[model samples]
Target chain A: MRNTFRASMALVHTTLGLVTGWVLFAIALSGSLSVFRQEISLWARPELSVTPSDPLLVDLHALNWLSQHAGHAGAWYLTAANERSPAATALWPDAKGHYVQRMLDPSTGSPDGIRDTLGGEFFYRFHFELQLPYPWGRLLAGVAALALLVGLISGIIIHRRILADFFTFRLSRGQRSWLDLHNLLGVAALPFHLIISFTGAITLGTMLLPWTTLVLYPHDITASYADLNPALYSRPASGHPGHLAPLLPMLKEAELHFRGTGLEQIYVFNPSDRSSIVTVVAGNAHTVSTTSDVITFDGPSGKILKEHIERRPVIRAYIFLYGLHVARFAPAMTRWLYFLSGLALATVIGSGMHLWCLKRLRRPGHRGHRIVFRLNVGILAGTPLAFSAFFIGNRIFPATMPDRAFYEVACVFATWGITLLYALLRRSNHAWPELLGADAVACLSVALMGPLWHGGYITAVSMTALALSVSFTLGTLHTTRKVHT
Target chain B: MTWISLLFAQVAIGFLLFGSERGKRIFFEGQLTRERQNFLKFCGTTSLCFSLLLQLFAVREPVLDIIQWIMGIAIEIIVAALLCALWEKEHNRFFRAASQHLRK
Candidate 1:
């Protein structure tokens, strides 16, 4: 092995990418879809017709429903209707104290009777959570993000001629073309790649690095959370039952206080107590920082008790980092950039994985390479296939099926598992085009089905899927004809 | 729309630079005049700053707009690279017309 600094970095570039490529690929692709999470949610549940409704009225109805059904819940949450998502949502503690969330039809102010599915939230959650239980998924995602950071830095070191190579792309040369593409994409979105990764790792920092919190609060981990993300105002519930003042007026008051960005989320704490608090958080339509300007009102009097706009540099820094990752404040144009760049990142990971396989294929004893090649094919091609299958499952499953949300998730994993099994079982050369061909079909199906069942900007998702189908078709054809170096 | 304008402006800078003798080593190669090299660098830098200002004035979210500007610059490099790589003389229809009109 060469002992130069660049060579060592090249080793790191290859190793880190190989180690984290599949997980990063999954995260990146899901993240690209997650960029349009709300739009996809609308497309998934076509039963909810888009109707212009007053936020105040919709929220009032949600409060009415909550007070009737879950009035005694320790707390209640309601999200106001927005342009992208017409239906509001209500979340409250169930009989078991665990949270239950349901969509509220703006027309009725009651729990929506629409088809049950996680919708776009499946991808948004899967982007970070990977459908695994709680902290494990977050931890894995955080680690993969960190690995991506190292890989990027190493790639920069190895790519000494970054400026020189910026305009050079020799197409149709198999391994060389992939190398150029990987470098091209990496360089093209370097700033985005750096920021997204740094912010992503920081977004899950508490979970990934528990020791940081432990250092500050040796005993009370909860205290650390309180300091990190403090409520606008909080208090213990009084034993004596007290009124939660009419919510619509308070919401209107908050709207005036927020000065027209609109109310995002409402929290009614200790709903039945004299010490009750209603915390209204501002929407992120106006600011880059994710920290909401909050106004906590006296539940009995419907007057503001405390208000907060985050100004602390330390906390604002943290909020800025988190907001950069979530991008709740981004407009449509910025969101598209996030989506397109995320796809480029995924391409980089896929090409890197393929590069690893391609290099080893030249060796005489290529048995180990075969396993990697199979894994690579299964993951790189299988993921988008499974993502499309999730949408397909949404439409194909009977609307009234119990636990339909779980079935949608299962469809994704099952498709992924079967593809993996097929890849491993079949010859690599045959597996490549076949899996990609299936992906193309699934994408095409997702694209064509959207107009039939849904309308509005949800066509954006369909159009994207249509584009993916075309790209996959081209890739499939190319794979069938090309011989790897 | 603002994003597109910023991107296209950056690509114009790309075109200007790639229009040179393999812009990468122009300074090193000494084939181009020193004044011309400096002039090219000035145009590219000025275009980038102009795009940054456009980004700033277009949106309320300054922080996100700045981040967007950086990413836009990064992406434009690729777009410019692709055009340079794949497209030949036929692609410079506007540029050819401008030159012909100037000669006339």
Candidate 2:
């Protein structure tokens, strides 16, 4: 009975891994890149690469800019310049209710001529949203995470000699080697894998598992949000125009109230009217909680209207999980560590897919096997290539072109689509090396483009590109050698 | 400094854990006895615990420190494994020469 149970678990593990492994690889890889989202955004917009200045001083400039550009808007969100992101950002709702964002020079309140691009936010959002509309993308991501969790659990159940295999790795043994590596990487960082996956799932729990919210707030989901985050709740705008009070004092008061935590975001509601309220949110860099402690003030009076501190244990735990998954509170070194582990996780997923293909290759002439092999090559190799294309597009595209961000994203999908089509049409053995070699060249070009055009030898983006180039070059060499063998 | 110390500690743990048979043949040029293996395991575990404590003390934030320690260990393990795999002959020669020198 025990043996049967183990066999069933192994079957489930293999099935779950094979089914969700490709998507999980894409998600993990994007997420790993997203760890440096701010850095990547800085890379994309070279104008914002200046060293960070005092946010309080920058806020005055930002407010001046907003008064000219966004004063007539319904509401405004001003994010102060920080160590990670030096550019002051402002977002305001237009007449159409769509929020438009602009990057501002920290010193001069004018709009920085940064090219419109999705930037690193594409990866961060794509990790969870998958570029799909609304809750469906989140639900899909949550399901994929759930599958990953199940795969991990079942993988543990099947590995009888988990401890013995911890130090056992056999190189150049084909399928055996792949299995060994999959086990080694998986077991080495099992805690991180489990924590990241579980927390990721829980972070989307309200959307994925809506039963609890349904029970609590059957008629009104907005009410639930209001209860959880009362500061975000809006009051009707009064028609009477009122003179705005000085924001620096209210910001100072908020900084004092939050024990000197840096201000992350300032939200002004009904900014042009008498009932205007300003919300100052404390930054999350010092704590393992993504939900900022919020202090709201009356815009005209500058009186503290509401203070929302997340003190409930459950809510705090949820916030911690969210923070842990996002790693927004992490320092630079720790953030790099997170990025490395995320890459390791991505490797684990890729190797599992490779192992599956290797096993299928042992039995030739299977149509389904060939298709899986093609897909594995297309996705694993194609994603990095498409990402490189996106970066290249960012550099090459005209900065002032209309709807440029849309084209940037379109370039990514177009490259990815073309690569996938080529992979599916060509045989697996031919597809792998060609795509990998092309990806290597693409990466190398991106690395060189910085120095060639911008005259900077070692910007963060170029360094990242160089690293990726080396990695892809090695991958190309490995594939060529494997094919020759 | 903290990351460097954590990395060294992880490498030490990896070396001790793999000192027994497979890694010994590949990298160390010496076999470990069963008693020595047990001792190495204990030492590795203790070193890992010590590293975690050091990380906690260094960062002073429980959640962030724990994550940093885990990621640091993971990177160290990958590096150690890759080093062993890619430079096995070089490692073997170095260890063999060191052993000969020690004997002299």
Candidate 3:
């Protein structure tokens, strides 16, 4: 009976892993890159300055820009400049109710020299959205995360020698080597893997498991949001035209009161009205909780009407889990540690996919390895090729080109599609080295182009790109040698 | 201060791995007695606990510190394994795999 149970668990583990393996690998790899999202953004737009400027000046500039352009907008949202992102982000709803996001310079509201591109935001959105339309991508990512959780648990049941595996790794034994690595990387960081996967699922909690919200507020989702976060203050329009108070000083006051560097989010309801309210949310950098302090002001008077710091224990726990997913409050060393852990997770996913192909190819009467092998090369090796192309496009594209952001994303997909086609055409033995060699060259070109700025962020990005090039070169040589043998 | 904790943690893992049978066989000829293994493990355990306490006390944000410690340990283990592989030399699995490939 015990033997049967173990066998069933092994089957479950294998099936789950293979089913979601490719999508999980893409998500994991992109998510790992997303850890340095802000730095990547800085690298993409070389026109921006290195040293961060005053938050008050940026906030005022954003406010001025939005008031002139999107003044009568449904609402204006701004993220004030800070250490991670020097340029403030201004977002507002258009007449069509579609929101537009833009980054602005503090010196002048207009981005005079900076090019329009997704920057690190592309990876950030792709990890969750897969570049697909609406909730479908998020739904897919959520289900894959949940599947990963089950797969990890089932794998633990099958890999019974947990302790020995933690310290065991033998290279160059083909299938056995892959299995040992998969087990070692998985078991070595079991706690981290479990926490990261579980929290990934919970981050999309309302989407995956919405029964509670359904039962609680069956009629109104907006009302449910309100109930969930009473801290998110809002008010209705008075419908009378009124002059508004200056926004920068008001924002500074709120920042002072909140004890934070910059306001994370700003919501201006009923702009240009007498009853307008501007609410600001800033997460506490002092703790590992996503619980933010909110300050709502009377828009016309700029007087603080309401102040809310989350005190509810239940909300605190949920936000804590969310906090771990973002890792926004981490200091420099801890942030790098987060980056390394993310890479480790991505490796586990990639290696698992490769191991499945290896085991299948070795076994007699198994035919699926042929297609899986091609895909492993295409996505597993090809995605990095696509990333390199994106960086190259950012460097080469015209600065003032219209609809530049659209083309930047298109360049990525086109490069990725070409690699996929190449992988399908060639035999696996040749495809691996060829594509990895291409990836190496692409990375080298981006690095050799020179640092976008002399600032720490851009320099770090250049160094990282150079390191990736070296790693890819080594990979290409290794694959070539294996093929020759 | 954080580096101090990291140093201790690395030393702890280094001691623990040095005491293991595989580590000894790859570097030395035979395993030590059970008593010696226990002593090495005890020292490792003590060092690891001390590192954890030091990290907890040093950082302003204890949560971040604790996470860094856990993540640091994971990376160190992988590095240690790779170092062991490199030290395996020609008479071990590296050459064995090579010979097998040649025969095939």
Candidate 4:
């Protein structure tokens, strides 16, 4: 009976690991890169590499720019530059009802002339959104997370000698080595994998299971959100033109009210009207809560209006999980740990896929095995190459090109599609080394070109490029050795 | 300071585990008695628990602090394991050379 149970669990674990491993790898890889999203953004726009000023000074610059460019709009949203990001940014609805964003110089209070690109936001959004239509991408990601959770649980159940295997790793034994690596990586950081998957699922809980919200709110998610976060509730615009007071004093007051917590966002509702309201939301730097404590002010008078602090235990618990999933509050060392953990998880998935292929390859003339092997090679090796191509495109593309950001994204998919095509056409033994070698060359080119173009030897962009080059070079060498052996 | 201490503690735990009979037999040509094995296991567990406790007190927020500790410890373990693996390879090479010299 115990053997039967173990057999069933092994089957289940293998099936789920093979099925969802690719998707999980994509999610984990992109999510790991997104951990350094702000830094990547800074690297992308070289003009913004200057030292960040005080938050208040950055906020003032952003607000001044907004007043000059978007004062006639319905509302304005300003995000102050922080330690990680050097450019203060603003977003507002234009006359045609289209939302527009402008990157402001923190010191000059004017728009910076950096080239338009998606920057690191592509990976950040792709991690969950998957570049698909609304809700569906997030739903798919949630399902992937669920699959990962199941695989983790069943994997633990099937590994009979979990503790004994923890310290056992035998290299160069082919299948045995692969299995040992899979077990070691999966079991060593099992807790982190479990927490990350669970929180990731919960982060999209509302989107994945809208029935709960439907049953609770019945008709209005907006109202539900306002109910959950009272500070989001705002009165209708009075529609009478009124002179607005400066935001500096209100910001100071809100900071004091929040006990010196950094202010993250400033939202101005009905900016040109009498019923204007300015809301200041606290940053998520010191706590495990993504929900910001907010203080709203009467815009014209600059008087304190309403303050909303999270008090409910249930909401606080949700906030904690949300913060864990997003990891916006982590310090530098902790963030690096998260990145490394994510990379390890990605390796676990990749190794599982390889193991599945190995088990199938033992059978001769298996068409499905070849297809799976090719697809794995394409995806596992193609993604990093695609990322490098995207960065290269960002540099080579003209700064003034229309819809340049979209083209940057197009460049990524195009490179990825070509890689998949090449993988399908060529044999696995040849495709692996060639693609990895190309990736190494691409990464090294980026590193070498950064100094010539950006006039810097050790900037963040160059350093990242150099690191990626070394990694890809090592990957290429490993693949060559594996093929030769 | 917390991260440094956590690193040292985790590496110590890794060494203790790898120094036991089971790990040594797998990685190195060595053996240990039952008592010494049990002692090493106990020490590793106690040091791990104490390191976690130190992490808890290092940060103010409960959930974030726990998450930080988990990531920190996981990274340290990975590093320590890799280091042990390298050390095992070196030890095997050294012993192989000594045996060859004795035979000659």
Candidate 5:
């Protein structure tokens, strides 16, 4: 019985690992990059890398401008500013009631840049949705996460010496090295991998478990939410004629009411309405979750009335879980750690696939090994190269170009597809070095071109590229020498 | 009393069951085996007793639906085995199916 169980566990691990290795790697790599998604956006568009945007300062200027411009319109929404840009953005209903965001310089109240530059939002959107039209992309990502969970379980079951595997890594042994690296990373971060996988799965559980609602409550999911918490769906009315009270005063009211330290977001509902309320949501930064307790104040009177910490437990739990998954409360250091860990996860997936190819190449009957090899090259090598190309396109592409984002995405895929074709056609012995060399060259070229293309110059970006290219060139030389020997 | 408490408790029970099962198999495989078995039996019976209580408390049907679905199958199997064992005690003339077949 024990032997049978052991055999079954091995089978489960091998099968699950092979099936989801690439997808897992991609998800991890993207997620890791997503931790610095905003910073990378700044990197991509070096043109916008100047002066950090402060919300308080931006809000003051934006409110004054919005008050003057929004004559007879509904309440204006100032997009909370941060370290990304100095422009303040406001969204308000036009004569047709459609929402439009206008970007204004906080100090001057003059228009600066277009509101929809897709800077940081590109990463935020790509993290879950991959820029694919709603539901489908996010659903795909969620399903991949579930697959990753299964892979994690199967990996634990299959590994015979988890502890021994923890400390072992082979260098200069080709496939053995790949397998060792994969095993080492997987075992080292097992707990985090498991929690991250499960939470990520549950984060999308509502979408995944739509059938649960169908079977249990056919008519009303809304009722389920209400049973959990009535305040979950409440929103303030619009079109009220009232000036918003100062943010600091409302923030004080929230701190006094919720008994929390900092404020997260201030939602001004019905800013134009005389009865409109300003809701300040207090943020407890020390906690893993930012399920804020809100204090709503009358916009005109500055009188605080409603204080809501959502009384229902289940609803609060769900909100907290969601917030934890988003990791909004994490400090910069913590985020960087998470990002590096995610990079290791990406390496695990890439190495696992590489291992499969290596194992197959040793035996004679594995005909599809070549295909797997090409795919690993295309995905792992091509993704980072594509990423660098996006930066290049962001700089080099004419600003007047229609749909600059669409063109940038096109450039990325074009470079990536070409790299894959070149990898497949090139000799197997030379392919690894060649592909790495090509990517390094592309990165370096783009890095150098940044100054030529855009007036803004980043010494750090250029230096990083130079270092990467030197390493890749040295690696290429070493590989060629080994092959000849 | 809070619904979040119940959710945490459910997760805790799952972990506890897994941990106890592992402990019994690994650390205490000798004299304490019977005690471990009895503990598991008691947990099973207590879970059955609280089935009704669980249904009454959590307002959401989906939550109840899932809980009942998992627990109902477990409870049914346990109750059936207990009944079968009691019936075997009463019917001394009748041999169990597997034993009678093996005798042939």
Candidate 6:
């Protein structure tokens, strides 16, 4: 019975590793790239930087323009520019249900004419959400994270020499090199792997906590969220005729009153109504909560209405966990380290799957492992190739296309789906070289055309992209040659 | 579950180290003779020291801290035993004794 249980657990571990392996690889790879998200953003739009003045100065002017344009409207929102971004953004509801977003010059408050670029934000979004509908993608990532935690635990169990094995990489032996690489990467960054997986699970605890909530609170999720963070609340405006005080004066007043870090964002509620309240969120740059005391002002009078900050330990702990995951307040160097570590993690997972295939192929009568082998090839090689195709499409697709981001995403999945199909139809051994080669070509194409297409060329970022693409392409080709010989 | 997983992983690490050292002498000279205990002592002592540092980190989380500390100590004890066995030049005999004990 114990033997049976052990086998069952092993089966679970292997199955989970294979099933989520590709998604985890994509998550890790993109997460690594996202570490340099801000730098990537600057590279994406260089024209925005030609201005000499601080973005904050322009933000105040833009606020004045917006306020004048708003006329009798209750409130206006201004998202100030910082180092990662050169342009300020303003958002307000304009009779339509959707928020209107416009880039403003920090020096002039006029339109910056800089095109919309998601920059590293794409990887950040893709990591947890995969551009799928919010709840579903986040939930799936959470499940994968749990599986990763299990895989890491089981992987150690199956390996006999975790440390002496560290210095033991026999590259001449076929699958041995891959296995050694996988184990070395895993053991070397063991702390990060464990912490990231655990914290990832915690960040999506909302999906997991429903069972607890159902058992204890009769399935009241809203009440649970409220209980967890009570300072957050929403109220519709009471129907009445009134006016809002000038936002510029209020902004100046708040800076003096708060005497804290720079402001994060100004959230305006019910901007058209008399009861509209403008909440100025001050930045807590040193800490992770992204929380500032909400200094609410009556829209009409610009009078200070309410000020509150979430200071409790439990809530603070939750924010810290999330902040680490998001790198919301992290310095640029930390983000880069996070990115490199994430990339290495993806390499670990990818090489691990490769090791499995190489091992099973060596055994006699390998029919049982064939299906797993084919699936691993399809997912591991196919996902990155598909992701590169997405970026390539982003540059090549006509700008006039409606829902460009949607189309961009569709291209990615379609490419991936086709790669899987190809893997199934052709010799499985061809999967790695072909898909990797294709991805390399596609990424190279993006790197070449990025300056032409985006009109912003920073030598460092472009060179990095080109180097990574070439390295991936060349590495796969080397493996293919090695396998053949 | 987190603590359990961590402990399980660390145990695997210990067994893995023990298994890899099989059929290999501790020193490069390749005889089974157990002279030069300095390297062996350093290995055990350094491992225990790092394990203690890891324990200090583990203690921040109350429920997991004790479990982590136990696992760390257990792994250290295993390492010490393996080192002593190597020093005593009786690891094979120790393995033989264990297998016989299991058979009974």
Best by TM-score: 3
As a whole number from 0 to 100, the lDDT of residue A468 in candidate 5 is: 58
Deviation of model 1 at A282, angstroms = 2.2
DockQ of 5: 0.01
Interface RMSD (C-alpha) of each candidate? 2.6, 2.1, 1.6, 2.1, 19.3, 10.2
How much of the true A–B contact set does each candidate keep? 0.52, 0.42, 0.40, 0.33, 0.00, 0.04
User: Please, what are the lDDT tens digits per residue for candidate 2 over residues B69-88?
Assistant: 77777767666766666676
Q: lDDT per residue, candidate 5, A1-485, as tens digits?
A: 23677677666666766776765665676676566654555555443424655555565666666666774464555554454334545667878987765456657554444323454455556666765787887887788778778777877877887633333443556676667667767765565567667878878887777787676778887777544433323455654456666655665556677664445555566666666666666655555555646666777788866666765676667666666556665555446556656666777777777776777778885647887777777777777677667767777777656667678877777987887787777766677777777777877885685453343225545664566567667867866776687
Ranking by DockQ: 3, 4, 2, 1, 6, 5
Model 4, B53-90: lDDT tens digits are: 77777746666667777777666656655665666677
Instruction: Give model 6's docking category.
Output: incorrect
For model 2, residues A119-154, the per-residue Cα lDDT tens digits are 788899999988899988898899899989998899
Candidate 4 clashing pairs?
A: none
Angstrom error of the Cα, residue A396, model 2: value is: 0.8
Residue A382's lDDT in candidate 5: 75
Cα displacement (angstroms), candidate 2, residue B28, comes to 6.6
lDDT of each: 0.82, 0.81, 0.81, 0.80, 0.60, 0.64
> How would the docking of model 4 be graded?
acceptable
How many residue pairs clash in all the candidates, one count each? 0, 0, 0, 0, 5, 8
Question: Per-residue lDDT tens digits of candidate 4, residues A1-485?
Answer: 23698788888888887787878898998999898887766666666546746878888878877777778788888876676776777789999989876667778777658666667788899999888999889998998898898889999999998876666666556898788878878887888899889998888888778897788888777878887778865888887897579888998888787775578788998888898989988877576678568888999999888899888898889988888877888877677778888988998999899889988898897998899999989988888888888888888888778778889889988999999989988999889999989988888877775573554323656766788778878878988898898
lDDT of 2 at B65: 75
- The single-chain TM-score for chain B of candidate 6 is 0.34
Interface RMSD of 4: 2.1
lDDT of 4 at A289: 71
How much is A177 displaced in model 4, in angstroms?
Answer: 1.7
| Ten residues in sequence with the least summed lDDT for candidate 1 chain A | A452-461
Docking class of 2: acceptable
The estimated TM-scores of all candidates read 0.89, 0.92, 0.94, 0.92, 0.68, 0.75
